[model samples]
Target: MTKHTGAWSGTVAKKSRAAFDGSNLYRRLAVRLDDGTTIDVEVGRALWRELEVGDRLVQDEGGTPHRGQSSTA
Candidate 1:
């Protein structure tokens, strides 16, 4: 996979967590970007808690994913 350059903006498709060793203890917030191409991004627990499906997500080059102006808003 190549490093993402510039910026990418899209809607949050879904939220998920990884389960390891049959234990959900290793849980982490994950989301699949619904841009033209699918991309998986790890989001912080704090931010994740505030995110909901369909929210706008934007990340710039060498930047972090953040909640953008929601279309619904």
Candidate 2:
């Protein structure tokens, strides 16, 4: 798949849920965009480890598409 390029700024709204299946830990992050929209994201364990309640994310847009990582979490 082709990748898009852009970055967004948002605050961590909440930590949704952290789930693990035999092999990996998928973490859910709820972030609030500057406009006040809340979005949830499914992050790989590695990336999730780097995030926290207030830490910011500077991710590649293609890495997580369904969650609209381009503009929010």
Q: For this target, which candidate reaches the highest TM-score against the unseen true structure?
A: 1
* Off by more than 4 A, model 2: 1-7, 18-25, 59-73
Model 1 lDDT tens row, 1-73 = 2445568888777777665567643323333455466666777777788888878788888898888886663
CA-RMSD of model 2: 7.1
Model 2 C-alpha lDDT per residue in residues 34-62, reported as the tens digit of each score: 66776676666666666668765544454
Residue pairs whose backbone atoms clash in candidate 2? none
Q: Model 1 residue 60 lDDT?
A: 84
**What are the lDDT scores of the predictions, listed in order?**
0.68, 0.57
**Candidate 1 accuracy as TM-score:** 0.68
- TM-score of each model, paired residue for residue: 0.68, 0.56
Model 1: residues with Cα > 4 Å off, grouped in runs: 1-6, 21-35
